[model samples]
Target: MARVAYTTPEGRARRDQLVRAAMQAFAQRGYHGVTMDTIAAEVGVTRQGLLHHFPSKVDLLVAVLERRDEDDSELLSTLRAREDTPLAEILRAVLRHNAQRPGLAALFTILSAESVDPEHPAHDWFADRYRRGRILVAEWIAAEQARGRITSAATPQRLATSVLALLDGLQLQQQLEDEPLDIDGVLAELLALLR
Candidate 1:
């Protein structure tokens, strides 16, 4: 008999379900702390069933990361496509969106910190992610500079690196503290410095 493909809506939903459950588990436990069995149980699926979608725990982590990135990319492309949208405003919007998804923020923070070990499955992936993220943000900053919306005093490369660092730091703080973060005010201050 021919093998059944898990490409239908049902299959995709199941896969998303597994990814969401895995994100929650990974956020709470970190990559090394969670197991394939735990993720499967969270999703109410057998280990074999979960494996059918994600062959390994590493694959699941990658999926969660990729899903988060895709969502951000889509949101940026869709909502902030206007040339009039300042990069600072875009950054603020992204911060707001992230605040609404604290679980994802936690997952990113925990995995990124733990993935520093060369032997970790997500080490290379996280490295590439940071590299690409910096480049993309630098390009955006350069564009804004060209448009004369941002100050030209700083190089785009430096500005982009700082922006990424600030974002990561903010996420870490939000995750570590129970008090609500003044994301908008903090982002406004950063934007002011950039301007």
Candidate 2:
């Protein structure tokens, strides 16, 4: 399918609409389970219309993931810019934000698990996301240690890995629990050990 230029306001809006529809569909059904036709129908577009904005299902998936990451990166950048904000608090805020958008959280949880197979379309994306996330978080931890805000007992890399693991685990648990998990409180208590 030839990609259409989403340069105009209406075109961009249409593209965004398709991405949102795809995200929700992919979240409700696993990526493999969702079809481009389903997303097009949800967005009130024809398959060809959806394809104009996204050449393939994988392309649409990439846009969905990128949109999620863009929002998160923006939030992280804003929180990290505050000199007084600690890493734990920043992370807690992010968790709180994710809690508010359960679909997005579910999307991440489901996709991350499904993408474990090397043959999965998102396998490389998830792998690279974790690698980059670990590195970025490790840098934050190292900087905090240098500033004497967190304990230096453990290497930044190890702490970063643990932090990411905790976040991922908590998100999965949150999805399963009958009662909502206290994500904020949990992060605060566990993360305090590092301070």
Candidate 3:
């Protein structure tokens, strides 16, 4: 249970603290393992204080996932801005970013399992998210094709779907506990196959 902080700058900072704490709890402990009290304690706040911002665990989970998505989107755009050439570099940047977000891996793992059932609240989010990601990646692939850097054989849509599948599957593997996952090596191999 993370404390509910207000939406002011200071409050947002506080809320961010709570979100991070809750993310850790949810990730390391899983969704059912976390309690509001545990989250509040992690953030050094009373349950009531936490409830002020997020009234339920479900709400907190949604917020954590949403913020994580927003942050990742910004980071990806930043990476794109830093280097638009060398498609491999762009893919590597995104892979490295995902490795850095341990909590997002856990959230994604749970979401993936739940999303298959159509009844899950996160189903629509994941569905729409993948669609958007595929579109963006396809556009990027088309651009690279236009630039003649990439071989203009496969259609951009097919390449984009493959790339997105790799990302999701890689993250899924990484979320496993006590499993040896070589995400970097896998990304390198995939980068070689990107063309």
Candidate 4:
């Protein structure tokens, strides 16, 4: 059988389907627990077919993470385009979006914890992700501070670190609680503290 180029529309759609299946599987069971065979079955593809798209489980995991980040970055970019939008509101929008997609949230939370070991395939990816996130957020905080929008005496780097930590903790807590946590409210309070 001829292999379809991933650049083709059909190939791209098939690849997306496989990634979504893998994301759900990885979210429910950590990366180690999920098998390529299982993801292939969930997407109605043969093992070879899945391999043709992803090459390996790690590749599939990367695709899943990239897709999640692309979605989040798109949202952030849209919100950030509004110059008047507060940093806290931008973050609240992100949290609200994550709450709507619990599977993605769970996938991030689970993988981030699991990939902390240096031996894990995704350890470097997660490390770089956090590093880049902190840098971008710190820059934004500094810009806000310069605009006199953020009144906090704390340095932008420290504030960025705290914000990222709070967001991660809130996401984990939101997943663990049976009752829905008011994530937006909590974030609002934290941002207020920064102000």
lDDT tens digits by residue: candidate 3, 26-80: 7776666678999999889999878887888878878877886888779877867
Q: For candidate 4, write residues 1-195 as lDDT tens digits.
A: 233466688989998899889989999999999999999999999999998888888888778878877897888788878877778877887787887888888999999999999988889989998899899889889888887778858798888888899899988987899998888887888678767
Error of 2 at 152 (Å): 1.9
The model with the greatest lDDT is 2
**Reference-based lDDT, each prediction:** 0.83, 0.86, 0.77, 0.86
TM-score of each: 0.86, 0.90, 0.78, 0.90
In candidate 4, stretches whose alpha carbon ends up further than 4 angstroms from where it belongs are 1-4, 7-9
Residue-level lDDT tens digits of model 1 in 1-195: 122367689998998898888889888999999999988888889989987888887788778878877987887686556767788887877787888888888888888889999998889888998899899888888888988878999798888999999999987887778887886788888787767
Alpha carbon lDDT at 83, candidate 4: 74
Residue 161, candidate 3: how far off, in angstroms?
A: 1.4
Task: Report the candidate with higher TM-score, 2 versus 3.
Answer: 2
Which pairs of residues have clashing backbones in candidate 2? none
Tell me the lDDT of candidate 4.
Answer: 0.86
**lDDT of candidate model 2 versus the reference:** 0.86
